[model samples]
Target: MSRSVFSISRLASSCRSRLLELLFPPACVVCGEALDRPTPAAFCRACLHEFAEFHPPYCPGCGATVPQPLAAGKTCGHCGGGKTRYDLAVSLGPYEGLLREQLLRAKKPTGEQVAVALAHRLLQQHSEQLQAADIDVVCPVPMHWRRRLRRMTNSPSTMASVIAQQLGVPLASGLLVRRRYTLPQFQLSPTDRLTNVRSAFRVAAGHRLQSAHVLLVDDILTTGATVTQCSRALRHGGAARVTVAAVARSYSDR
Candidate 1:
């Protein structure tokens, strides 16, 4: 009797989904091609295939792809200076081509669906690395209140929430707060980028991250300044270690 009831419920849900699809046909977020059925991600197979994944020969410390392969645990020239505050960083892919287009779209109001799809992809591809890191909690690089209000959404927070849920880790969304508004990192020189975000983040009081391993989520990693600053704040708040996980990395210093 229970099995029969479950089957009926499943059938009803299938029918409802078909009805909805009929009412509003699903289209690929990237290409606008009609989809035969709903996909785990909103991308059509062709567009999904176009999305590149980052393969190694990358800097172990910063996750930046090196021009040539390096031995295990080797740092790239850029990260060899020991200047980064985060223990390590990882990104899904380079910030160009399809990934770039999708990420830019993700910043707009109409891009929530695609943004969610991208987050799902990020988790699918990087879950193993994240699990190996043994993170205790996940946190998004917080946006200033004013910017969040203006944007009506924080993509990093959204991605972090999804990642935390998938990894069964707690998300400390409120623990890290941005105290100052800084110029966009992309617009600043590498040196200026460092100063721009200096002292911009503060960990919330009463939220002790003592010896916690934190995974910091952000949409894009450029010069690494933003995440570095965020990592400093997390460490100051007593986090034992911080690792960054971003959707894309911009290789250009600018």
Candidate 2:
């Protein structure tokens, strides 16, 4: 394009931004306060400051919050052992308060924007480690096709797209898939959670990992069953490493 055309295009984009700002002011998702400025993460400055978010030192294995500044190593009991087959894990924080509210909303079909925003929030919060993890590809914990068709939106994959784009990695979607639908983890006993998701996932046939390091994304981590099972499939299918990422993790209240 010519210099004149470039300048006109830039000016038109600026005008569109300004017009939108005037017509619909940006507001915080949590507190509904008008934002002085907004990024894709979308929370206002005050809410960002006041929110009780998760921070390290993270448990090296399961991504659970370790009370002290511990280095990465083994599976923490919070997620139980061996079952958490992923090499490492990271989470936005424990699911509670506004964070829990956000996740619950994301489960609905109308909550696509909420799901996308939460993915940005997770990436924003864990930017350093996630970006530095040397991940070759990103994939969401796959949903069963039947349920996905019924719901009309797959929140985890939707979140995974943002993560893959931000990380400059391929979104290896359908790399892992549901073999059969299982009951929701939250409804079962911790032991049942294990058996429930066991054998529920499998690596899709043509997408062999060839030992690539993978970052598996999920919207929530409750008992850790689903993700661990997903990781098992990835590892068994030849992934060199598997790390799990969740937008929120639910800890037992007791």
Candidate 3:
């Protein structure tokens, strides 16, 4: 399909979502109330107010919201005094309230609209960060093909496409790929999650990623295992820098 037609299709899908809201008047994904027009992540006013937002004093390296200012040169527990591959990771809200519900919805068969809306919200929230970071490409954490076929789509891919549209960046879905089929990371212990995803990704050969700054988009950053592995794959594939961005971050690192 022509690019213009493809864009219209996406816009049509978005409009369909709005129509569904008008017909059903979607209950707040969290608090169960009608949503305002131009909804952000399909949240209602009360639920938006209830969301736990993340703010500054975050670790510059890892981007986890620092609970409190740490001693100079100290790192957050999640960063764990070890280095991370990505330049930084930023999230809009904590993994609770409406934010959590929308993220979960993004995983469901019916969550595509929420995923796209959340991606737009994320891009708006990080406009400056994205612009300053010189993000040249957007790549989503890929799902294994078997899982992708069953899910009918990948939430991260849907989100990345929306982000690319808003930011005018190129969405590079084929650059990095999932090679292993594994159990859900959430079901595993933090340490096990890290081990489970290690080496699960590979970059497409001859992609020429060298010196390219990337925005790695995903729905949530829990143990950071998934992003870490994806970032490593990107760097290994010759990306100059990778910055992680997600809709929410899990409150506890442990």
Candidate 4:
């Protein structure tokens, strides 16, 4: 049975690859370099290396860049002082430069390819975190149904699903549901931001969620209120522990 399943999976993957080549083929999000043949989903060799590297010995709590030789990994003053719900958060890097442009384009109407590419890059950075963490299930920071209907895709959820697939973990879509369509968070003040996202999410009760360790996935972590709200919902729905993983972490006061 296992053999049959593996064979079927391989066949399905091959078919998908062929289809991708047939229509809307893969290209590097950075330089428009061809990426269809690359094993890892990213830009060409040069552009891929240009991405900022997040090495270990960093803060396990916030994924913040920290100077080494300290008692622990890279930890900022704020995280060490405490005020976060999720035990830890990991991000690939700040969403700036080419990375930010690519991510924004992906969220736009005609940037599906960029989204897929960024999802691949995110997996490469977070794979070890996924394996080492006590994560039993994966959930995405969902977009409101109305926004999803208008945008035609939930970029964060799509990226999360791809990461889950790569990590061989279960992607539970129905686990976390958005409750309200708040205004664009960028324009809101910090206080209003928290208020806006408060009670904005709910996790459904089910076999996949009860007492499970969840990794909440998203595209970016800015003020972190979005992730915090999502984590609250997951915890309220009986998540034992929740960890956040994002493609980029916006650096405040940088």
Candidate 4 clashes between residue pairs 3 or more apart in a chain or in different chains: 58-74, 59-74
lDDT string for model 1 (1-254, tens) is: 69999999999999999899998898888888998877656778788677677776666566666778766556677665454678778887878889889998888777787778788887777777888999999999999888888888788888888889888999989989888888878888878888999999999988999899999999998778889889999999999999998888775462
Candidate 2 on 3-112: residue-level lDDT in tens?
A: 99999999999999989988888877767788887567777777665546777777766566667755345555675544457777888876777777877778789878
- Sort all candidates by TM-score, best to worst: 2, 1, 4, 3
lDDT of 1: 0.83
Pairs that collide in candidate 1 are none
- The per-prediction CA RMSD against the true structure, in angstroms, equals 2.7, 2.1, 5.3, 4.1
Worst 10 residues of 1 by lDDT: 74-83
**C-alpha TM-score for every candidate:** 0.86, 0.91, 0.80, 0.82
Better of 3 and 4 by TM-score: 4
Per-residue error for 87 in candidate 2, Å, reads 1.7
Q: Per-residue CA lDDT of candidate 3, range 1-254, in tens?
A: 99999999999999999788678875655556665554556666565666666677776545567877666556677667556778788777778776787788788888887787778677666778888888899999888888888877689889988887777889998888888798888778888888899999989876888689989988888877899899999999889999998888774342
The candidate that wins on lDDT is 1
Off by over 4 Å in 4: 1-27, 34-37, 69-75, 78-80, 205-208, 252-254
Give lDDT for model 3: 0.79
> Which candidate's TM-score is highest?
2
